[model samples]
Target: MTNLLHAMLGKGLGGLEQVFLDYQPILEAWAAKRGGRCVGVVRNGGKVAAAQAGRTPPLIPMPAFTDWDPITLGAARAVVRANRPAIILSHGQRPARVFAKAAPAGVIQAVCVHKPSFDVTPGTHYLCVGQHLANLALERGAAADHVHVVQNAVRPPPVQAQPFAREDGPVKIVAAGRLHAKKGFDVLIRAVGKLRAWDVDVTCEIAGEGAERADLEALIKTLDLDPCVKLVGWTDDIAGFLATGDLFAFPSHQEGFPLTLLEAMAVGLPVVATEIDGPVEILDEGVTGRLVPDDDPDRLAEALGELISDRDTAQRLGAAARELVLTEYGPDELARRLEAALDGMLVNSKA
Candidate 1:
């Protein structure tokens, strides 16, 4: 039953880092109890230096991907040589490719498909974050029997009621994600602009940081929404931040499975997200959240406005959302599911 979960970091920043970082502590403690080990490989910054500084176990870090040298197969082979882990679980596309090559014959390899990427390798099993991603992986050549859907989970902060009174006032709308083009924040800004024509008193707060910050800010000003829109950068605490808003909006063009929607639901906020794959799978249109056409700010805005204008309905929906998350997305339950999946893979491989 000896095992190790190898989490590799590609870029020094972004949602992937945030996600893998959150799980490191949990996996480390859990592995120690089971007499196994889990290691994180951060490829940038003071990762290697920092790991050595503390009494914590060592993790591998390599040079950044370059034109001449892609992710080296040798490095992956060396890691497996050192750990001698019975199973390898690689997160993200590139890691999967490297692990597929590096893993010894008979070692189980589970690759996580976070988004659309050209990283699929032959004879590799997949752990998709959402149903859409599971389907995408199979369609893109991953064996159907080798793939499983395992949704991401977050430890919801203590339930906090909206700070501002829930009365009918300025409709505070929120869209959260890294300020990347894939997030479709510009589309959200445009939708907000269109909503203004209807004299809807709305203010949108885009919370996150990325390359698209300047562009989105400029769009807000150009659309005469400088007063109505604000781009708040990344925050350590999301539930508390979202508690100040009335509705949560996500217009991402693509996703593995966004924890943002679930976080919002846990905090009892009614959602108005794009009817994209991830959101559609989590939200039932008239139930936990409203699903609108992707990139269509018109529908997004209309849905946001509808939720804001009706307080009783909004409260009812919010209550339902919170209940749903508690019942279905608990962190402990999710961890158990992951452990079971890994155990199944281990047992089936031996058979």
Candidate 2:
């Protein structure tokens, strides 16, 4: 049975971390069914442990950023020796660098690229989270055959007896992610302001906390969107939150296959997202959801207005989005693809 180690530079509960938490158990179960094993390795004292909540194969916490430090490297190498993993799948750049040096000979090393900026080390296979990221990896000198595009997946939410959002009440719009500039929460807030000015009865709830919380709060106040826009901090119940919203607005300036967007789609929320790499790949312009230009509040406002004004269109798009995810990006399908990739890597290592 092949033992696999999934390693990551654990920091916060962002999309990357979420991907690790969501897929770790599924991958572990898949491995177990095949008479193999999957284990997780993350930086010591990071939030990843809390997110895992006692799930397994098991999680091994090690020092982060210890790229060639003899002592830490020795410790990591010892873990590798003890586990004897045939495949080491590193989540981000830092973890990739650390594992590349620590993994013993014969162990296949693969890096999962979850963002635009990544290190394309020679001889390491890359699992790009989106097609756009895969293209970027190829441009950065990664071997074309070594890079694989793996779309993020989510389980469809339990069917609700009744639709969550009220068609008669003020439309509830939800957007989630780290409160950072890259997320473009400011652009979303401005869009909400414009909608409010046009007398559209809509309330926007920005979930998840980060460094940009104060600035976002200040912008909300400046725009006189005190009651219309609320910055709700980090939420563990993302599915429940999305269930209550009429629409999902993702105005991110950058992304690498955002799990929340998939989650939103799974719950049948019509999405209005920025026309960036990840969103462009996910949303089919007006089919699954509406796409707006990145960082453009006016265009964002226009898109939001279109969905808010047309409930029928919103419901149709949301349903289409849900079907798209269920059919193409389900957890089981993604897990199978991952298993195939791991198998391919093992064979390549032998070659």
Candidate 3:
């Protein structure tokens, strides 16, 4: 039986962290059924503990290292030797770099890329969350045969008796992510300002906290959108928060298959996202949702305005998006795909 070790250096509840948590159960079950063992090695054990809330496949906390430190690398090498894993699945650049160095001979090293950074060590197989990311990895010196496109997946939200009905009051729009420049919350605020200028009764609420909170708040104030737009920080129940909204907006400048966008679509919310690599791959133009030019607040506002004014279009798009996610990106389907990729890597390592 093949022993597998998963390593991630995470400090907060970002998309990569969420993927680590979500994939744990599936990977654990797969290992168990095959009479194998799965172990997780993470940095900042307390942060993962809070995010996981006492989950299975017990995590081993390793000392955090900014760069390649001998002590840290030696300790990681000890863990890999002890486990004697056939495969080491790494998440993020730091973990991949460390694990690639620590992994013993004949152990397959696979790195799951969740963002734009392609600083993976040489000879590491790439498991990308989207096709664009995989392409980027190949462009950045990764072998084509080593790159695998494994898109992120989400469990379908519980079915509501009826679709969400837009109330007669303000159109409620919700966006969630780390409050940073990459997320483009400032552009979203500007888009809301444009909507308000057109006298559209809309309320925009953004969730999650980050380094850009102060700047985003200041931007909100400068736009005088205090009454209509709010920065609701660090929500635990994203689905519940999304349930209360009628539409979702994502104005990110960069991403590698954003899980929040998947969550929004799963919850049956029509989306208006920037035409970036991640969102464009998931959203069908004029079908599932609207995709406007990145960094263009006016175009974003126009798309949002169309969805807000036309209730029928919003409902249609939301429902279509939900169905698409359910059929194509279900957890079980994605898990099988991941398992297949791991199996292929193991076979290739032997070859």
Tens-digit lDDT track of model 2 for 221-251: 9999998899888887888888888889999
Superior candidate under lDDT, 1 versus 2: 2
> What is the TM-score ranking, best to worst?
3, 2, 1
lDDT of 1 by residue, 1-351 (tens): 375756564664555665565556656666666788876665645443344445466656754453234456666667788777776777776666666667778777877667766455666777777888888788888876677777777776685546236456678887788889989999889988987878988888988999999999899888999989999898767888888888788888887778888888888888877877787878887888788888788888788777767867877787788888877877776777666666667666766
Distance from true location, Cα of 301 in model 3, Å: 0.6
What would the per-residue lDDT of candidate 3 be over residues 233-350, giving only the tens digit for each residue?
8777888788778889999999889889988888888989999999889999889999999899999999999888787888899999888888988898789878888777877777
The CA lDDT of each predicted structure is: 0.74, 0.83, 0.84
TM-score of 2: 0.94
Highest lDDT: give the candidate number.
3
RMSD of each: 2.8, 2.0, 1.8
Q: Model 1: how far is 72 from its true place, Å? A: 4.6
Q: Model 3: runs farther than 4 Å from truth? A: 159-167
Off by over 4 Å in 1: 29-34, 46-59, 64-74, 163-169
